[model samples]
Target: MTSSTDLRKAFAPTGKLRASINLGNPILANKNPQTGEPFGVSIDLARAFAERLGVDIELVVFDAAGKSVEAVRGEQADIGFFAIDPLRGEGIAFTSPYVLIEGSYLVPEKSPIHSNEEVDRQGIRVTVGKGSAYDLFLTRELKLAEIVRAPTSPTVVDVFVEQMLEVAAGVKQQLEADMNRFSGYRLLPGRFMVIQQAMGTPKSRGSDASTYLAKFVEEMKASGFVAEALHRHGIQGASVAPAA
Candidate 1:
């Protein structure tokens, strides 16, 4: 069995818990408008986990999910929140998801592509955030349609509009918000995927640390901590994941 001291050593070797936060996923995290600080469901969870380990917390923030995942995979940060993908699992040991978010596609209101299936046809170009979960998933799934990647998730729609791409793929809430920013766009009814948002530490942390983190996630869901945090953050279109 892994003792509490061993768990601390694995999680906070630098004497503080370093959490890699991605502001790209609006449902998980966002920046404070007035203070320029990180605050959201992911931030709240990071703080709570640090408190559980009885350590001070440090946020290693990034504007893109890929950068955040790299920080944890390279062990530059102790842990991070991410959408579960098999590619990322090579370096990171992920917990059962604590939040479930929808991934959807957006297109011009008059686009001939009315359904998710229609967007994959030849000559239809899609834009997604580089190194994002949807990007990874679509890379494997889309055979005929070309994928154009934006520098970050927040810019997916921007790139789509700027480049006149046929489709934009990203977090459903983000796509919905982008609809407001860029007129003449509509989301395909239903989702293309369900992104499993979870916490992860480097696989180097060992099975014990991974197991502990998994338990923590399950507890957060059962205790309604995850649900309350989402509500407090004013996030919509995401739900607490069921217990694992």
Candidate 2:
């Protein structure tokens, strides 16, 4: 294995960094759709990367991290911000667990189910985006319950809307009604796991990239940019654990 010193030299040949962020809403990156200026938590993190690198940084925005990851994997971009998932791990290297993500089931109040555990006890179904990280996790980890996967993100939104209608019309909503009252369906407490959302070049980029970037990331962590980014975003519960 290449030593960390070697890795750092590769990542910061001139002591500068180039990174991108996902501009999707609520992602901590909200840049102009056309011009691509950095914004939000992801942008803030990028700033830290630049500051620590001691070089000018460039920022680009994408529709979402899923797309941004493509840029990183292709080497069109050096790094991108995104959520942690098994499939994404296949394509890109992540920094470390930089943030905590809390995912919960949403439904109208006064539904039959009171907690998330009750959903799997019966025949209730859950709707989620097709091929999404959440969908993958639910299918792979929560196999006890049945999930009706929507074909796309829009359809997932539609499912939520349809559920809202069901509640408005007094029918047990598919997703909008209380997870329990829709007949024992509900989201459970989000599992606590370290989702290290790290950054790396493509596996094809070779060991030099990983080795170098890894050390730079460690320095970024030690310098407190990661923690400051988390705090700036009011992410008190999330963590910035050391990846190395």
TM-score of each: 0.98, 0.66
| Residue-wise C-alpha lDDT for candidate 2, range 1-244, written one tens digit per residue | 4554454354444344557665532435444568655566667766766665455667655654456777777666666666667787786776555544444454344566556555553455666655444555666765555677555433453565565421111111212323433442333344322334566566665665765566766776788877877677654445666556
- Report clashes for each candidate as comma-separated counts: 0, 17
Error of 2 at 2 (Å): 11
Give Cα-based local distance difference scores for all models. 0.94, 0.54
Candidate 2: give its CA RMSD in angstroms.
6.9
Best by lDDT: 1
Highest-scoring model, TM-score: 1
Q: Write the per-residue lDDT of candidate 1 for residues 1-244, one digit (tens) a residue.
A: 3577998899999999999999999999889899999999999999999999999999999999999999999999999999999999988999999999999999998899888988888998999999999999999999999999999999999999999899999999998888888888999999999999999999999998999999999999999999999998889899999888
